[model samples]
Target: MTINFDKMFTFSQPGRRVFGFGTISRVGKEARSLAGGPRAQVITDSKLMELGLVEPVIEALKAAGLETEVWAGVAGEPTQGLIEECRKDIENFAPDVFVGFGGGSSIDVAKIVAGLMTNPKDLHDYFMKDLGVGRFENPSKPLLAVPTTAGTGAENTWLAITSLDDVEGKVGFADPKIIPPRALVDPGLTMALPPGITASTGIDALTHILEPYLNANTNPFTEALALQAVRIVPVFLPRAFKDGKEKEARFQMMMQATLGGLTLNYGGVSEGHLIGQMVGGRYHIPHGVSQGIALPYCLRYSLDIFPEGLANLANWWGIDISGLDIKEAGLELIKASVDLLKELGMPWNLRQIEGVNRDDLPEMASAIATQPYFITTAASCCRKINTEKDYLWILERMYEGNFLD
Candidate 1:
């Protein structure tokens, strides 16, 4: 097995993590500790509010004597326009501490609001070139993130993702200053997620773990988290999907998802996230769904370049391949990935996405080729993708459900 022992890798100093049932009640005191008598803005979506999740946190904050205001307008995927609206509300609230109190979308918006409130810059100022306008260097306010769903690992990451309509894709802003000061992960919060959402979000967590684990740049720190996360998901995701009421499954998935986020923040992701973003950007497909569709094929494509990594992954899946060659072990890993996807009810190809067609592949492939992460991350994969033509080849295979080919 080849290891990049001499390669340099950067690891983020993660914030404090408080995990367990009923931890949501700690939000009030936690917020206050981060900022005394904090006037907090709780960024979330209307659906969460309707689900009766928002009121309890609001009440808890009020009980702790903190002034709390709820911004429940965030809907669908985040965009520059959506974030600007959130920033306006944050400025009015003048919060000393911010709380991201829902899924990835809500957390992403709150991260942006927290950063922009202190720095006062346009969203575009911080975005990488392929996704947005420019860069902004500044610190954001302290934030406490409470994730309601087990996906996106938004609570653990410093990167904030948003859509650019002009480019019809997702872009991100990354800096250490934007990492949340505290993360409250309560598995109880995820018990109400619909089966479809539970499956999609769980798969998204798997993607975050698996992509970076197989990347050429992966180091020991990332490998530890990724190995644990990958091991847990195949077992727990199906259990959680089968019954959201299962407390044990919910709890494990929550922890694994956060670990996946940590892996992405530290080691970075590869072609799965790259192509997933392209599809999501173009079709307005939900992020997790796109990731679910892209991951298996992306893994298959990595077989030759990352045989050792894939063989190890096969073992993680509990696939015994003691006497098999590297290629055989890698193939078993791909099959295990497919079986897991089937158990989760995730669509494994572009054909499954309603209203999508092969004709859409070229445009999506072209757009991803322009994104720098796709180029950089894929450079480390088995099949390096350097041009739109290369991305198109991959996309065509994805569109046709050609995992074996």
Candidate 2:
């Protein structure tokens, strides 16, 4: 409900989106229209390759009469080294069009590689940091994202996240030129996702929606997309998790993820992502699981600041908030999110993640406080997180899994 009217904001998304069941068949046709030459490249992960998902995309590209190369090297979170490696492999191939055909990681690699191909800069220069000199001087090759998962919303957003191993943190390239001009979102592609992935990614999508919607830096356009996507998560996420073949559930979740990405483009994320990125980068936790663990705690931290927004969220989830004060209703919303995390079999505390310990909290808190991206985006959070102590307070609660307290 809170909007910053002092400064103007801009909203953007991919130029075109094709969604529905069996839309993968149209990738060939779409690629033909976007291609400047006969060469095309598909960036994805080896897991998807083993699962037999990458072949269909390659076949689609080849069917359109294009010479295609497959880079199935993307694994785990994208790193600066990985991006450079992918860039080296493809710089010589020089594809006129790119098909990012997997989860967020693969799509992110595709986006960064496409950008580097045209912009002649080290991947580190584009990192979202104080000293980062990333500026795309030329337009990137046309990219078409094909999201096989219903979580990351990477297919629709321009930002590409990468891990900085030496710093034990994550950063992104925030440039409009890196945004995919077209996307193919087919729920059918996610049919083979295991229950664990279904749950984690679904929770990841929820974090993306909640952070932007609840943040002070939001607009009518962002709120509408976020609200719609938020409603779908409670109803459909469980169904999709319980049965991966649930067609309607998968379809709705995929739609929610795409909309969540759109909200990120306009609204952006805040504290939850900041903490999640840091912990995930330091401990090698899965991105969605890290976000899922931090989401309710972050919401609770900001509850008093966004009572009306939280109350509205409770109503959307069909919770009866009659006769309750706005703060109480907000607490109910936070409890619901925690409950959903439990239902999805996600970790409820930071301690549950491997490589995380009580001693690491101070270092993690300090890293978040000093991180350039966090420092810039912290102003947009409903609750101010200005110092190491502020971050430590939240991190302590997260470590102990203390929700109400």
TM-score of each: 0.94, 0.96
lDDT of each: 0.81, 0.84
Q: Which stretches of candidate 1 lie over 4 Å from their true place?
A: 128-136, 165-168, 372-385
For residues 56-150, what per-residue lDDT tens digits would candidate 2 score against the true structure? 88888898999999999999988878988898888889999999999999998999888888888766555545732144668899999999999
Per-residue lDDT of model 1, residues 131-209, tens digit only: 3423357667889999999988999987777766564456666667778989899999999999999999999998888
User: What TM-score number comes out for model 1?
Assistant: 0.94
Give candidate 2 regions above 4 Å deviation: 131-133, 164-168, 380-385
In candidate 2, position 153 carries an lDDT of: 93
